[model samples]
Target chain A: MSQELSDLDRRLINRLQDDLPLTQRPFASIAEELSLTEQEVVDKVRQLRDDGLLTRFGPFFDAEALGGAFCLCAMSVPEERFEDVLTKVNAHAEVAHNYQRDHALNMWFVMATETRGDIIRTAREIEHDTGLEVLMFPKKREYFVGFRVNA
Target chain B: MTLDPKDRAIIEATQAGLPLVLQPYTVVAETLGIAESELLERLENLKKNGVIRRIGAAPNHYRLGMTANGMTVWDVDDSLVDDLGDKIGALPFVTHCYRRPRALPMWPYNLFAMVHGASRDEVHAKRDRVAELLGDACRASDILFSTRILKKTGMRLRGQKG
Candidate 1:
């Protein structure tokens, strides 16, 4: 539960989701909005990172346009080898994210590469590496995840 | 959609992050020997064209105290998926919703929607709301929580080499 967030923390989460003002000392503007000192805002943000309140800060770049393509791929693993397979699959530099879902396609991971061929190559390599059939669910269409879950 | 040399360089310069300074874009522009306006214009263009999703802080939900995140998968009738997906995606609690392929017998779900909340029960309740919305269109579904982040990196920037 998001039970540990402070009042200031919740406000920061809500406001920071928007792009920070493109000014020198962007934190200053944010501080003004929250009626806190610039140093306080900066310190709070740093603390949030240390506390894991923020996963990332800065421009969110598009992978496909940046000379690379990404695909959401998954594999069904035998219970005995789940952890072992996860290690093997994640060892590849191309694999950016991996997740265990409650479905037959239980083991899911995202593969990114400079080219589409590279994406396919890595998918095959993951199959060989894990001794499991890697089901490639390349994205045909993607919808923006603009979900703003309030704190 | 690829960027020209200048655009590529600009992206490369700020790809890591905008230096948390007074004039972050200006700092990037100075390094590239381009006017700040030009750099800003290109960024604006990129945003308009959907190349850059946004310029903001991506806070970790778990850290922000809203930790229960579930990847809710739905097996809706093929014909009704897109229509239903739009509705599901629009839910304030649901952040990402999309139509993914069904792997059949084993992977029977095709539509995916991500829901987040303060607790697992909160997420489960949201899932129920989505299920009720789908009604008979959704045959079955399940939720998957991410266990770990094996690797984390930004987009693969070709500008690094070029």
Candidate 2:
């Protein structure tokens, strides 16, 4: 849990997320609107990231639109092999985010590929490389999982 | 980070709808008239550059029986946000968690978490667990359960005219 953001930081980030200006000097545009310098805005964003306050700053994609397939996969990697499995899993560009959970299905990750073949191929490859069973649960019906960072 | 014509084409085509076939990449390659390996390599490069976040299935959780989902916000102590966020994010029910700038004059809660379950009661149970974990450090919280899904899709980086 965290306290509220400062007025300046809140406005800057809200503008950034809601409608990132598409201009040559995007930061400058944002800064002008916020009554801050472009450098200040950039610096604040960098600081927020360094403080681990910002998960990430950028565009989110629609996986289905890309002709690729994706699924939420999990596995229980032996403690001794956690690092090895993590390294191999992270090596694949398809893995968006992976975490070590506190459960029987400890390791969980998201995998996406340009095509269905690539999706299956990459999953199998990871299984072969890590020697762990990857349980993939693809989205059957999507419900809204809003990413609005509430600012 | 700049994409060439071929790379843009591949992104546009695949983002449109990767052919649902045994050899989807091959279809993309054929349309692009390049080797499959080339297409693969380009995708790898795009991902490496962070131009594309991921290539995966965006599951319709509601269709799979986990219909209840809510955006739970917590007023966590600023000093403990990082550790608490990591712990909260590690929960299986919490598919997404992040620290966003707090909403002004309307919503003051900063910490946010999402939980999904088979039913509203299930989601509420999970929320109770989170509330217990959070304890007194939280000042206020709210759950905005979704009533409708607007739209969902993958990346469309190329088509938008800058």
Candidate 3:
């Protein structure tokens, strides 16, 4: 269920998505732009995060630049062991984003590790752990990344 | 180039999220026993090196009224992948796009582009546009609308729990 959002909240979401001033007084600068007090802007930001409206509010790091390996892996688990497989796959610390999709290659997850070999090894380990065939789809190239989302 | 110990420290400190304050650097640096100016300088350098993509508010798509999202996969001819992937990635609504290796029989889609919208119908329309763009070079395709997100941690190093 979606919650009813206020006009201020909508404006905040659109504004905060970009134009985050990098300054000594970032919040104060935002207040100046939005005509609200620094404290009010700060409080609303806190509330948005608390309400799970804003997932993150800080430095955005790209894994590839940090010498880390990131790839998407999937598996087609039997329906009888779906829950059991989900629990096992989700338990790993390296699983970045796991999703239950509507296809035969259903169980899809993003795997992040320190090395390229880890991407291959993790795929094998997951297959062994889940007793299912793992299809590793490591990114060969990135055409575009971190594109601006529509506000 | 290797990561400086100081840079590593700074990233670890702000990995979760930075403080919501006037002088966030001052607060973060004070905790790390460093000067605000010094932290700012390092952050600037990191941004230049592409380590830090951005220092801003990363809004949740669902909260922003983008309730429908799908990962559109395509099996395009290898010769035209570079041409096709770039074209699809350039779409305004495509958030994330990449070319990945395909496993035969089971998985034939090598190109992946993320499609998101306010409704499922909207998502399908976007997918059709992509398909039309791919044309005959695209041999096969499939879209996997995420039914559930079991786990999601932006970026985590080995053995590091978020």
- Candidate number with greatest DockQ: 3
Models ranked on DockQ: 3, 1, 2
User: Could you give candidate 2's per-residue lDDT for residues B15-114 as a string of tens digits?
Assistant: 6444433345676789889988888778767666755555422333543356678767777787776667777777767877766555444546667687
Name model 2 segments beyond 4 Å from true. Answer: A1-151, B149-155, B158-162
Best by lDDT: 3
lDDT of model 3 at position A48: 86
Which segments of candidate 1 are over 4 A away from where they belong? Answer: A1-6, A21-32, A36-47, B148-154, B159-162
Which pairs of residues collide in model 3? none
Q: Write the per-residue lDDT of candidate 3 for residues A4-77, one digit (tens) a residue.
A: 77778777876777745556677776688789998899889988888888887888877777678887888898
- Candidate 1, residues B1-162, lDDT tens digits: the string is 668888888777877766654456778889999988888888877777767888877767665567678889888898888788888878888877878888877778888888998888989999999999999998898899766565566555754553
Best by TM-score: 3
The DockQ score of candidate 1 comes to 0.54
Error of 1 at A114 (Å): 2.0
> Alpha-carbon error at A79 in model 3, in Å?
1.0
Structural similarity to truth (TM-score) of each candidate? 0.87, 0.48, 0.90
Query: What clash count does candidate 3 reach?
Result: 0
